[model samples]
Target: MWQKVIIPFSVSFILIGCSEPEPLVEPSTVYQCAALTLTATVTDTGLDIQLPDQSYALVETISASGARYRDDDFAIEFWSKGNEATLIINGEPFPLCIEEGTLPTSFSARGNEPFWLASLTGQTLTMREPGSEQELTVEAPRLVEDEPIMTWSIAAEDGLNLMILDQYCQDSMSGQSYPYTAYLGREGEKEAGCAGDPRQLLEGVTWQLAQTASEQAPTIQFIPESNVAGFAGCNRYRGTYQLTGEGLQFNPLAATKMLCDETAMAVEDEWFRQLTEVQSFRLDAAGELDLVLADGNVIQLQRKN
Candidate 1:
């Protein structure tokens, strides 16, 4: 006889590199040490061991009740009796011939069981008399309530300073480009496009540039969020970005698979990657943000919602 430990969900834990991650509420009711019986059955391309359709990720069949099975890399005790076994599964079947030789043994901890071996699927199991017409039929294990769970979660975005900018430039040859886009540190909903179609992120919220290169002026269309999401000139890019006191850097930046035979998009990618080092952001009378890179190259970002 054994007792199960109930871990309260209220327990606080310190997470490294994460600000504040939410916790899950433990179930009000928990299962006892009562062993359950389950059958593992094989399907076309998946393992139907029990629980839910997508429950077992790497098994050939699902199992229920008694024993369990998993791939290698587990701490549970495993055994393979030529894939054959006795059907003495409590009140279930008895003396069964499982595909013993081809099947392997595996297990994992779930529910109250710390390390239970698996007896499901591919085992050489047989029964005395399944029915009057048949001697024995191959059976799979059924997934039970005592199964394990594997999940993932994302971290919070708190106490972090961010700048949102959006800007596009057009060459005399009609070529379009986006020099800069960032989160400037504000949460407002308003705008002013006094100097032509200035970029707009929030409704009525516009950012103008105080300084310009003259040789190349950028156009803006204020939308929401930052410039990483939408079109960067004729090209489109979507990925993750990071900004520090020293500068900004983007990674795994990808774009649509289209005809970029022109140099605008190419220049846009190269220039953006090269300008990994940023100094600061400046605004103009028209409500726009300018990007100051390490090499002294500045690119004005326009908001294009």
Candidate 2:
């Protein structure tokens, strides 16, 4: 009798030990989506979601693909896959929500017609025009009335001011879309423009002259840290380039003294002249780089394989 009782108790203990353990709760994660930014914390039984205006407690539900959470009381649903997510509220779906990149500390803006460029880094604002440039040390930009707009006021005699709005902007000339709209004002003059980092399009690619048919066409490579080196038909050239907003300028390039044939030297001379005249750059529909000259001409270049 004692043997039977001990066997039954041992079996009960084994069954209890084999029971499933509690689910582990994950740490909080921030998601920047297309429609909104939200923070989500996965709990053992549900998910805690925090939005800009409100918060919701969501429970895990069955999903065909990806993870799905729902809060019936709030009529909210969230589905996530990899770094992308979809949010649903009141039976409306907000799809194609992607994660955001790192925040930027510096910004650049440029306008057309008169053509001006401005870069803001820390407390220094650098303004550049065709033949002039000025740097101003000013206070930090202040947000305007809880809106996504920033304004910088300068105490200079010229009454220079800058305003940047968090809005989608398209370049007037290049047709490229930017993330910010910018306005620069000075003494009754205000210039409207687009703002973003333009260097991502130029860096990490070696471009060759597309307009030339010669076997030894001019090739240019833009390196990081404001350095540029390239072959200018007859000789190799090296220089530092300045890129601000939409503007691009090669500062006093120096070329090697190696002499080539008359044809090559002529090509080099023309290339250098065009480089000097370049005021801005745009990528054509075919993805070729077009260096826009001051006189409305374009020297096209193709990406080297």
Candidate 3:
């Protein structure tokens, strides 16, 4: 015969705990990756990116920790910290080092990442995936003269590419044309004005002669009223100018009838001759203006800032 035994409260609790165990529950965690919608131009050599309101050559720095884009059933992500960056295509990761103050040409040195067969032709961009037969293409937006808009294009993957375009559209409420990208469908801040106002970029800025043959460097000023004025080392001159697209033309310049040293006068004469041969213009990365002449001569001008 078994004898009935009494257990303490602690023993009874231990027995209950041994009879059944509680199920474990795991916490759900979510990882957030920053997504960026940038206008990408895929070219034969590489890619070009810019803000909707800025020039293709000039792109504003994005503050996001990372940017992601998806196309052709594939996704690409970029993580940027300072000048160093990492790009993720699908699931594979590649390291990239970005150059400051300018646009990048390639994905660091790792642009050949088994994907993105890219090419560009005119305003069309074409791209194709490696090991796949299908391709994707995107075309750039069109522009009209005096429409306050500029455009650039990129082609991805050997005739398969994407075109990115920008337009200056005024907000109905503000009555101001903000930089807008139709490809991304978003408007950015004043940085969109990074392309700068065409008038301000052309007017009232002083350009000092750079690397000229003259003993005294000449200078030129393009005033806002379309008047051009500058000193030709020995004499001050005034004229009218017209800017059509990238073409720059100066009307006949009238100079003060002042005679100076023989050498100085000779230099002035050459300066005036070079000025009359101007055809087009180019702006370098250092903000220097190159007034290209018909004879392939460049009269470089350093902006006074």
lDDT scores of the candidates, listed in order: 0.31, 0.73, 0.48
Tell me model 1's lDDT, rounded to 2 decimals: 0.31
Worst 10 residues of 2 by lDDT: 148-157
Per-residue lDDT for 1-305 in model 3, tens only?
99999985653334433556675543211111111123444333333433323323222234445433333344544444533344455564422323222122321000122333333333333334565544334344223232344443333334422222343332232222222222211133111111212233344346888776667778887764567788898999998987653467789999999988887788799889988898766565664567889888888888653
Give candidate 2's TM-score: 0.43
Residue-level lDDT tens digits of model 1 in 1-305 = 79998987786889769567676533221111011122344444432332212233223224443334443333221121334332222232222223311111321101111211111123222211123221222233322222232111111132212211223222122121222221211134221111101121111222223334332222332222233443433455565544332334445556675554355555555544643554544444564455666677766665433
Q: Give the alpha carbon lDDT tens digit for every residue of 33-115 in model 2.
A: 43246788888878988877679889999999989999967599989876567778786554344444322346688888879
Rank candidates, TM-score, best first. 2, 3, 1
The true-versus-predicted C-alpha distance at residue 228 of model 3, in Å, is 0.7
Candidate 2 wrongly placed segments (more than 4 Å): 1-170, 173-193
The global Cα lDDT (0 to 1) of model 2 is 0.73
